[model samples]
Target: MGGFFSKLGLSCGIFCALVARFPLSAQTKQAQNPVIFADVPDLSMIRVGGNYYMSSTTMHMSPGVPIMKSTDLVNWRLVSYAYDTLASNDAMNLANGQSTYGRGSWASSLRFHNGTYYVSTFAQTSGRTHIYFTKNIEKGPWKAVSFKPSYHDHSLFFDDDGRVYLVYGGGKLRLVELTADASGVKPGTTEQVLIENAGAPAGPNTGLPAEGSQLFKIKGKYYLFNIVWPKGGMRTVVVHRADKLTGPYEGRVALQDLGVAQGGLIDTPDGQWYSYLFRDFGAVGRIPYLVPVTWADGWPVLGTGGKVPETLALPASKGLIPGLVASDDFSRRPGAPALPLVWQWNHNPDNALWSLTNRKGYLRLKTGRVDTSFVLARNTLTQRTIGPTCSGATALDVSQLKDGDFAGLALLQKRYGLVGVKRTKDTKSIVMVSAESEKPVEIQRVPLTQNKIYFKAECDFTDRKDVAVFFYSLDGKAWQKIGAPLKMAYTLPHFMGYRFGLFNYASKNAGGYADFDYFTISEQISKE
Candidate 1:
């Protein structure tokens, strides 16, 4: 990947100009909270030498457990994935009307020890916890290892004594030992309760009890971080400390600002330590925020005066676009890969159903089988739809589409809005469907004779007034509003932000395909 720019004939001056276009970190500029603003949740980060690598949870989306790299902690780019596929399950493949929207994989733990990188994630759909290890973290052929009985939000810790352990479980935190090879649990080793209710000294938890547990040994003292929701309160961060690995631990509240909790820690080479946490920003999924950590009296304290600062003594944000979101021409450069890392399939996609090289400059999405709904569609390419104000547009060719095929741009979520070309046995037509409140209902339709068309969806999330509008174009320059305003929402069923998706699904026939020429995004003035 390092040679990608060189293959594209980008000179040093051009590269420097491109770097200058990205966000600049001034000497006085402080890193803002929510460093990476996308649905990068359940984060577990580690610093390898001068480079920082973070593994995050992208549940149900194929190429799971995304590994991101950043020179500065603020700007990150997706480099690799721990697993290309989770498992062969009906829920994972969107079969039998079942989907693994929020339950495929959860809260991953990333670690680097003894010149090797390890990432552990649990999948409810497969009922197993997978451990992936690689010598080279960025470029890889990562090997997979899994065990039965998935532990909820577990942490993988390797101690100095050559002992490997898994610290896992919910309100009652438990610890179990693994074989030296990390194949499975060591038999006859007693699994002990590490912390009861995450040692919440307050009353019994009224909200979600202690969960999202991550353990770390800092300064030769064991420290564990967990997120708990108090009664009628936001998500809170709780930390516990102990001298021994498996002993009685003391606990306290670490942070409570906007529910940014539940990640491990990373330190700079210069010895500055910070806790990587995430907050649930509506419609954009869980966004990661960095908090400064200082040691006082042998305990790692978070933030200033128990409050999360808006800015930190680190690199400024690069605006979550360059790496996380991008405008693509669907054309591969001299040595470019077929697709950018920013794109992901809705679920485990049928590899044979999509291609970029098959058609020189267009993305060809072929339907593998018949589907009843969009949720059951097999190949839906998606990217994060950033908030405040943004719009995504795509031009699609429906000439090769068979009857009952719907191919177009969609704002995908539980309650989604779709503007696409729906082909019938006799004619082709453009339709707009909105799932603003109830199930999707068609709001408008336009009969089409041409085989190609352009579509766009604009989203506004300023002041939490989430809404989406759809538009269509006969010519690329002339656009027409075609649908009622969709009251966009962030629902738990999807458990994700609104994503701009290019989807092709067969409602009746099977071998239909669509060609997407390009996809572009533009940030607009806030509609607040």
Candidate 2:
């Protein structure tokens, strides 16, 4: 058999060689700007040895504060998350009318000090500043520490003198010292106003104030990075420098093009510096951008010729698919994770309501209670929707769905759009619902005859033309457009980008369930 296969030129070594060559060609020698084209915003990055680690905000998404790892800074993959559930509350549980839709944990600061990895974030819903620490970041069983009064867009910094501090606030930045273990604020240390009018450097006319403070100590000088928005202008990068950890600090406007601001810095192993920031790119959310940095007369100048470049000297992108966001077949072997790292719940999930073991090769989401709207539905497994265009396709097994159960795929935002199977007492309908207005309006409904259904949500964020359309099919091969185009907008209420989600919730009765066979994501949108 081996000799016959060799004669046909189908040897195992030949097949393995072809597979190895594909991945190598996927990553180019030079990197591209907007390093990641997903909703990875408010980035805080750190370099430990040759590896670069980053953390980003995912407000209201449980398994919050996603930690990502990269070797060349362009190609990254999700490693772990800081917490499984941020807080256990009525809002987090999707109970009552209260929902932490846009008000969960905000920005996070990731740091490594003395062999311990630390990530800190603040939550308005929980009203606390949370600090999580682990000896191992990749495989973390992190321990949590909480304190009252959450800080806004704070940076956790470890000074050279062994003192830890948190620099935070908006417009006017403030500072507070943390204890040795970073449990709480140091005993007698009062919150001091660090930079009074931190936004002043940008100009007198300001729309969005300076916030998202990330401080770094480079070459014995303290450098502070913040984002400021000038009136009638875009999001801008402002930097401050101080000889001491505390003021008096001098400020300057760094990079203002393309509204790409609000992140910190990371250095390469070979001594090259880069500014890590994000741009608010419509409904696709705030995508990350990498700007080359150079020191000019003691100041770190951002971008090339004072503009964000489209490409860089670093390694090229290996793409975000199967890394930042991926397709899941819901099949897992023993000892493997129930869901991939790319997936996150809409909010704190009810562990008892979801399982991969209840049925082999399927994700079973049982409705524990009734939800009035799709936004309040629990157990909605989600991943970031990427740009310039992408589509999320799912095969749902609705044979077990009870009356009043709704199960399908959704493009989740404040004003969301969904294509799913909605069952009533007498009939099952394939419905397309758009919540572009105040209430969810069922745009179209077709009678669903079969138990198994295929649903897809295609999003186009090209040139900031944010639009999404829903499609449904009895067979996975052929699709029919179902609804009015969803005019995707970046609303402040959600505070995050749109996510492709698999959801099942009850409108009237509980205990109804839906099984998802698989969720597949494609970088290209398919035409019906």
Candidate 3:
């Protein structure tokens, strides 16, 4: 037995060393490079002084615009939200127990100029683009500016000569030079620079439809990085350059068929340039991908394929920035916040709705209005799906729930698949799972000895078909399984990845709250 153990240990060490010494391919290198944000789509990034700030499209989820801050181009933390409320009631009317993952915010832009941070969003349902500006990026006193730019995936860029321009519209690219005051478009500045009907071979689906336009000037040449949506296919990133800010620019392919391209240009101090792209992982929504840009013969070659590289040599190690950490301890440690980088709200959030106080050692979420749709409603605590094969666990104390009050942990993929635990007056507590059109299937119902409860849900993405497992605990140890594994698939129409977090709903008449503590996630590995 000792010989066997020693051999096994040696094998493991050899495997680890092999993995550590393996040379990353050019494609793998690009994919493994650390990015400040992950899984966030339609990114617009800007450099302010020495810090970098970024924002991405937040579909129906409230606290609409998520703002992140980082010193290096790699590590990022959620700093604040651009909008606190959904601003529209249509989002609140989604069918009860439905998932709305891929339908809300599309591509957005974040820019800093003249002591203000400007953000623009395309609300698909509204079909109108809106822009907001704030003097401070961290603590916003934001003001909304209205412009009926009937388009999606908009971006703003300021030229070297201090000229502002808006690039947007789909199927074609539009550029409108803005006046010096940044109030409106300059006279005769509107022009359609590139049309999808022009050059470029038709993809297996369809050729790229221009979108997500960001203008930049390098070496006196104007470059526009545009997001292209192939007909009936995934998103691609393409670039066009011109000698003049407004002109007949030449278009070249940057990234093709990698995923949806969002976010704009992000550069390191060492003069290395990378564009943050997004990949749609259904239920996981859109996650961030980094593509390194190198100029060759005066044209940009993204990744290494003249197309998006799936992998590449990792960024130079000297000035390397660490990737975002997925674990959370909830210790709060004086200055730490409770939420992680993946968490987002539909609208702006009020600090009073949450806290880490007393000896609770848990997240306390007060019950708010119970609206069927999460898109327009407030008081939802949610996070993005980080890994393909992972499990999330959280302990909840629901002793305070009233008759119609329910608090539980959920694995949500929009209005699609959901598995959770809820407390009721008659049942005490029950474990349930449901999908977009499927009925709420009860997995287990158990009477509670104490009002407080501990709950957990594990999502196993190891299998081709993702499986979700639910469990509950009374003392935070001895856990009991609630049901057979619930199977899920990413190929389902509108289905996305699973998001794990806590939520609560109160009857209009019942005033209640749900407290959650000790949330943790683990990566699954092969078992002997």
Candidate 4:
């Protein structure tokens, strides 16, 4: 029997060698772990069947609450949007050209219960909360349900006893029980589980209000996780657990100070749990960060050891989970599409203005009139800056534009911090300029005609308060100083990091479009 087994092993080895030598097709590689999907913030995820569904706050961008689907914890793709029309004409008219940076939906909660999917968001304009539900996740003809505004960062909690509750606000944590129909709060059913000024280690600070509440049950104890802001600083996630779902809960710090942390807990089928956190990387705005969570005593802890871990080795997911890759080379591949995960717009996105077709090998952006207000109209393709010190490069050809046409790259921080190349018919020259809050101050204007120009912007976020911006004309050639390095700290009410992208603004109508060869973003990793 030993001799026969040895012969069988040798025969199997020979067979494997032959198969390798005469391979039918290229072997598919297993997806990498901790796949980075940049700029996805305030992440709320739920496991449905064998798939994971996640959603984040869309702000003023149309199609609010971007719903993403994933098989493994990592590798997410945009599936659908919760709100079809983000802000209608009526909603925008109410905004009145003001920026809704902190006012829009901060953090949103997504949950699937009893074969139905539910999502809730805190709309600041009306000072009211709205919940939407759909029978199917992908194709959502979502119906909206309105309630009194508790606060931003709202979440839904379903008790095991067939009762539902809504938890929201940070400073004054409000929890109200709901009827089974989820129509309105149960008659005479209202409770304030945690008050901001009452039970805090330190007194409640101004501006640094608490909000973004989430409830989870572990080890038969219910934990209420929420964000707390302490007197002019970035908000952090904290938790308080109680023996009963609704009770006099004790507040404890789960995640503190450490940059900005939002989002909540998601449990995999295998019982492993993780919490999503957001960090503000200058020029990247707030990007998502995942941390392994564990329950200690009764409080929850994030990261590996109180410190936020940059990367980790996650357990292999049981089945195949898709990966997140918004990068495009424009060389038509089997599954490659023009639409990426990062592109967003105010109001409904016009599909006619953008496309990836055989005629244009690059992403062609049609020139349109600049929206008088940044919040109202700006045709820009942007992605979050995930690293403090990162660089983005893109190749653009604006030769088709007549005078008064401008197309270039930019590093955006809300209404300010825009640096790029522009072209006007006056001189038929491509000028490099920087805009701080939509005020375009000429930097360095250069001439380029009928040639595809390469543009790059590097943001030194080591000192985000004083960010430096530099531009390069070609891939690896002469680098020119565009303008005086500007201080970005005072640009907005809340100073978040910068975002990079390609934008085209036309003061006068231009017949042609701006064609982009490609856009690439890279973050510098600290050696430590």
Q: Which structure among the candidates has the greatest lDDT?
A: 2
What TM value does model 2 have? 0.94
Q: Write the per-residue lDDT of candidate 4 for residues 170-233, one digit (tens) a residue.
A: 5677778877867667788867655544226333563556666777777788877666666655
Best by TM-score: 2
Model 1 scores a TM of: 0.92
For residues 1-528, what per-residue lDDT tens digits would candidate 3 score against the true structure?
Answer: 999999999999997787778744422323243242224666778777678788866666666778877775555777777776545544433434443445555567787777778887766555556677888888888777555554556667777778887777765666666676555557777566554432242344545566667767778987778766677666677677889766777776677755646445667766778777777654444566677788788887777665555543344322111122254545666666556545655334445666668445777777555644333334556665555555667776677776666567776653333334455665565555555344445555666767666776766553234666677778878877775666654533333345665676665433567777666766552232
lDDT of each: 0.86, 0.91, 0.61, 0.63
lDDT of 3 at 260: 44
Which residue pairs of candidate 1 clash? Answer: none
RMSD of 4: 6.8
Q: After superposition, how far is residue 4 of candidate 3 from its true place, in Å?
A: 32
Provide the TM-score for each candidate, comma-separated: 0.92, 0.94, 0.77, 0.75
Across 1-528, the per-residue lDDT of candidate 1 in tens digits comes to 779867666687776786678645443477887686567888888887899999888888988899999988888888988988999788888878889987788889998888889999898889998999999988888999999979889999999998999999988999999988787889998999998778374346547888888888887999998888888787888889999999789998888887787886789999998989988877767888888999899888888788888888887776767677899999898888777888888988888989988888999999988988887788899988876678999998999999999999999899888999998897999999988774889899899999889998998876666788899999888888888988877898888888999999999999989999999987773243
> Rank order by lDDT, top first?
2, 1, 4, 3
User: RMSD of each candidate?
Assistant: 6.2, 4.1, 6.6, 6.8
